[model samples]
Target chain A: MALEMLSPALILLLAAVLIGLLKGHARTAVVLVAPLLTLWAVWQIPDGVQGTVKFLSYYIEPVEGSPLRRLFATVFAIMVFVGGLYAYRVARWYELAAAFAYAAGAVGVCFAGDLITLFLYWELMALFSTIVVWCGGTPAARAAGIRYAIMHLLGGVVLKVGIEGVVVGTGSIQIQPMLATDFSTWMILIGILINAAAPPVSAWLADAYPESSSTGSVFLSAFTTKTAVLALILLFPGEPVLVGVGLFMVMYGIIYALLENDIRRILAYSIVNQVGFMVCAVGIGTQMALNGAAAHAFAHIIYKALLFMSAGVVIYRTGKSKCTELGGLFRTMPLTTVCGIVGALAISSFPLTSGFTTKSMISQAAVDENLVWVYMLLTAASAGVFLHAGIKFPWFVFFQRDSGLRPKDAPWNMGLSMILFAGLCILLGVFPELLYPLLPYPVDYVPYTAGKVLFYLQLLLFSGLAFFVLLPLMKRTETISLDTDWLWRRAAPALIGLIERLLGSLGELVARGRVRVQRFSQRIAVRYLGQPHTADREERGVFARSWPIGTTALWIAGLLSAYVLLYYL
Target chain B: MANQDEPLHWLVRPATIRKLWIGLSIVLAAVVLAQTVVYIKGYFGVDAWFGFGAVYGFVCCMLMVLVAKLLGLVLKRPQDYYDDPDKDTGHGQDAGQKMSGTEERGNGA
Candidate 1:
């Protein structure tokens, strides 16, 4: 209770703001110190830190503790530290502030005890992450940031509705498993799926991430979707639909990543692909599968960050992000080249890397479930990952034809951060037990079986072979790939334009009809009033002019005679 | 003038095979060390495990390099691949004018 008295997230958030108040190395020191402090606070969260406080009729539980939560929160904290290191030299103090706030939101999500707490942290993550994207300070970044915000806010609204429905119907706000057959639960699933960059709106990630600043993309790669993965693992484990959706995302990411020419966009697609594995594991819902999802999320954040850092180094040194403008830079930047290759291999699930240990569990689970088709697709996607991100990224940026540009190696801070992440990727891979114990379940699953390792090697190596064999099809171009988001970004806008045109014509016709009616009414009024002789005759005929003295007496006599005649008849 | 015509610009030349061999050797050594650590942890301390690990790593690295070369073929584009030639015509002529100005400056100097 006393620990709850001081919100650790708010403390880090405020510290970040204060850090923004400082300048120079002092700013960097403060930025670096905040995550360390936040990490210490996070480590201090005792097991089962759950309680409820009443807000009117609503009871809110803000702290939930489990190994899964701890795993995600720990990685989020590590990301902050590494991101701070990567960003300290180049990013503005405000951007650092936003990054810390965003990290705090992610950590908050990890410990969120109830739906309300989850939604609160979820929306906070969305808000600060958008600010991080906008901090790129480019017109493109600003537009992408707006689109990102719109998508996230839409996700938040759907999530809020679901949370409210669950609370109203169930009378409890505790975060727990729910079945998909229920309407409220389905809404919640959809809300979280959107954040996970699931289809139909997944374009937001690729659209926004590439537009972020060089440093911003590194931080951007860490939090938003991983948090959604954590939420799904917690709430909707064992849902069959997720397996299908996850496979779609996996292939979707690979094909689109194959099509992308921007270095950051390729990495963004890979994020979706990696998260797809985790989502599938959550769908499996077995103990090993859940652990796989959790472990994969942990490894994903590190390796993805490494990949982004490498891309960031390239962009920072050259001021170019497109793969076409970059090539043959390894001659100048060997450290960056090495770091990128480490990340690439790790992401491709090479036999001795972090991705190999974590991603295999999900595939193993698919096999365990006897889902032959899903397993085969996942195997193909594993190879495709190497083709699109693992090979395409580094090959284009570092080892392609000489572009005659000789940029210096990445700055010391950037190189150091990359090395740290590279080491982490290898550390987790070689010693899976270190990460395995940190998963939510017991550590019974082994990732180093000979059959599994050899299978992965053959699959990934063959994919590598295919990449070499099909190099002509993967050429870089300036054109953006049309994604599901095109439905809203392009098609929706065109539809709106067409509707506006139709309404404009209809409105003109209505106005013309009103004018005609007004003219007709005026003509009738003039015809009735303008004829003076007819008007006078009509007035007299109504007994207005003849009812005077003699006219009134004659009328009275005539009326009396008529009455007598009628009576006699 | 001799230095200018040396044709040994680091940016334009591929890395020597010697350097590639050294780098490969270092990566193999790291993988062996990693396997040794794994073996010592009571997991599978088989004889010649490090050797196996090294060979495995070397093969993977070669495969990755081959993949990288192939990807380059597929993904590589000309520096100006995205630039529109039609739009660049006017700018190209302006650049020509600037080149002439620079040449005049060179002569004047």
Candidate 2:
């Protein structure tokens, strides 16, 4: 009966299945309704209710009361709704189903109170997200999906090992803040970092996200890394190493995004960049920093999804993603262009957008902690965000060289979703209270101020000046930029090939030696054991061949006499 | 849908600088209005300043475009960079359509 009451996770899971059973417009309607139902269920989760169950030897607790968890779950549920609307018409029912299940996993993760529950939901998220990637219905999509799954499963394995160690060592599975001094904690941190797309393996995000279907990318962009961020915040908050790691990721994303030719890849890298900010905030470990990280995750999901949806529409209509192949489409798809620009501005942290409100708090915390260099780097990264995502994406996709393609605007459902998210971005930007109150910590920080606002304007505007003046240098081309991933993707493969060849030659040498040794041993055995002169003499009778009868009688008598003499002696 | 061959007018070309200015001004006005509302709601304070975030955001975007453009000069191959121009393999359905007649030699066999 309680299960029948429909939790947010259950509602979304059912909606996904129901959508798969429907067709065409009916499927679209089902997709739209699914998120709303989940939203209602999220709202119904009563405060301070600790939902738990015992299975096997472990206690699974998914607490449903914390403002932080509620905030994330709420936005996740809302994202599913908006994403559903954006994708309803074009996407297959299976994709929609996977998307909802993925959203449910995210929500389920938010409420997971114990390590076991968290791990379960975390792997589930991986499963459904992989399905979403495969639903792109392209060869590239399939390949990307496989790569995505491998990376996620690797992360999951590390996490499972860490969880087991922690349970064994601590004798408790409560989800609590952990220090990185011990092996188990370090294992868990590594697990979370992998999901966050920290360096070396970070290329997976850019590599796989763009290959997904347009609608699929929208869902892909929001959930995975952010969930990792949440996990990190829950376990390993305040680890100073994360600050450096996060900063590296932020700058790495911007640089690579600048070099990327694909529009979605640019956005994908920005996801890394944005999550970097959150990661840094978590490292800061102050109440303000934690709050900032939580709030940024909330806002980032909405705006990033909006950007992806806008791009999806363009790609859907034009069948081109490269900036060089596309341009000046704003003439026809004005609404999409506007919505995209809005998303772009928000991502760039333009004042009065969701980004400005949510992202600035982290920087402020950095300043408070007197992390002068980190603050400056973050500020520069903020400027770079505008350059890569704010201007580059919109400029190339909607307002560059006229590609002479006259495609209709995105379908009504897609348009409506974009409009809704665009409005939310602005709304939260103007009214930070709507989100600030939902942070895990008490809200004492203000987002809008004269001095801070002026300083940010000066910094960002100069960055814009730099971009326009150097336009010739920022042209789009069809090339993949190399990163740390290149080591594994290219160099590692080459190294493996060389090693294989060397091993093959060694194997040949061993075979030749074995043959030579076998022949030598056989020859020696034949020489020592052969039947020859000795055996023939023994078989032949004494003097039988010549002078047989007469000589034999005399010889016998002489032999008898010799035998008697020998016996007496 | 407008015809592709129509003569270019100032208002429509680049969607017109005038239109660009107008649209940008409208966005600016909207931002101002939103700020005013926040201010009235007592949400604006020492933390909620627009000038810095706006200018910073704009400059950052411009810089990104420039960097991408510079990279493009070196990195951008021709439109058919990945495809073999002379090899009418027809393996790529879209590529086949784009390269119907030209049979130039491919760089990498």
Return the top candidate by lDDT.
Answer: 2
Instruction: Write candidate 2's Cα lDDT for A1-569 as tens digits.
Output: 25522346777877778887877767777787878877777776766645566778876666555777778888898999899878877887788899889888888888777888788888988999999988877655676678789989999999899999999999899988988888888888988888899976898898778878899999989888988888888887899989999998998788788887678888999999999999999999888899999999999999999999999998899777766567778878989999999999999888999999999999888978878777767887998988788888898888666667678998898999999999999999999999887888998888887655655555565565566666666755445676566566557867999999999999999999999999897666545543244454433333222445887799899999999999999
What's the TM-score of every candidate structure?
0.81, 0.82
lDDT of each: 0.78, 0.79
For model 1, the stretches where C-alpha displacement exceeds 4 angstroms are A4-7, A524-569, B1-109
Question: Candidate 2: misplaced stretches above 4 Å?
Answer: A1-7, A24-26, A49-51, A513-569, B1-4, B9-109
lDDT of 1 by residue, B1-109 (tens): 0124346555444466457556755754454455434432212233134344234333443443455445555654432332234443222322333344344332221
Give candidate 1's error at residue B106 in angstroms. 28
How well is each residue in B1-109 modelled by candidate 2, as lDDT tens digits? 1235866635456557768757756755554445544442212242245453455455556554555556555654443333334455311423532352123122110
Clashes of 1: 2
Error of 2 at A223 (Å): 0.6
